[model samples]
Target: MSSPRKTSPGKRMTAGLLVMAGLLLVREFAPESPIAIAALIIGLIALLIIIPAYFRALLSSRRDR
Candidate 1:
């Protein structure tokens, strides 16, 4: 039997970013909803924060290899 593989942090962050992007797309059709507005705000903030961190981690990890 094969053991379950562990997911790396970078991959987890990518999934999160993809989800956030999906929410942003959904927000386009429901711009009047307060919840969607809040989600857009939160998602933008997360993208701003996570994108930089993801790139830095990716670069550092590659350098370590």
Candidate 2:
């Protein structure tokens, strides 16, 4: 049996930020459209989820050192 690879939270956070940036760029092209609104909501939710996890992971890693 193989152990699953662990992904660090910072990397996850970076990916989430990249996705949010992409969504923002897309939204700029269609500022009042439904798709833009949905993208904004999704990006906000992603930041809400990932930012906390990243901070928690950062603190835990420091304690392990």
Candidate 3:
């Protein structure tokens, strides 16, 4: 008998939310300063990369089950 698969919805949601929050924080902190803008850009890049990866992993895990 195979064990039931685990769906980490909470983890996925938390990660996505955290990344979004970080992005918001970066934007709010340095809306005009060049360094803040750079950080915001970097945060956006990271968010673009991370959120999808997290969702993909979550979906793959669910599919595997």
Candidate 4:
């Protein structure tokens, strides 16, 4: 049997996606609410943060091999 490996970036990206989905649902119910806008902004920020972090990890791992 083989153990499965975990990835931090993958998890972060998945979390970002889930947050965005939740924000979309909120927007559908209350499009003009401040809370919906706030949730959207936070979700975008989380998604943006993951991009560079993922690339950096990929580049560093390549250099090691």
Candidate 1 TM-score versus the reference: 0.57
Kindly provide the TM-score of model 4 when superposed on the true structure, using C-alpha atoms. Answer: 0.59
Let me know the TM-score candidate 2 reaches against the reference structure. Answer: 0.78
Sorted on lDDT, best first, the list reads 2, 1, 4, 3
lDDT of 1 by residue, 1-65 (tens): 99999766677688778878888877987888897978888888778767776877788799999
Q: Of 2 and 4, which scores higher on TM-score?
A: 2
Better of 2 and 3 by TM-score: 2
TM-score of each: 0.57, 0.78, 0.49, 0.59
Q: Relative to the true structure, how large is the alpha-carbon lDDT of every model?
A: 0.79, 0.87, 0.71, 0.76
| Residue 51 local lDDT, model 1 | 79
Candidate 3 residues 2-61, lDDT tens each? Answer: 999865655655675677687688778768878676776766776776677677777888
Candidate 4 lDDT tens digits, 6-50: 666657666767777887888889888898889778877977967
Q: Is candidate 3 or candidate 4 better by lDDT?
A: 4
lDDT of 2 by residue, 1-65 (tens): 99999878887888888888999997999998999989989999889868887997889899999
Best-performing candidate as measured by lDDT: 2
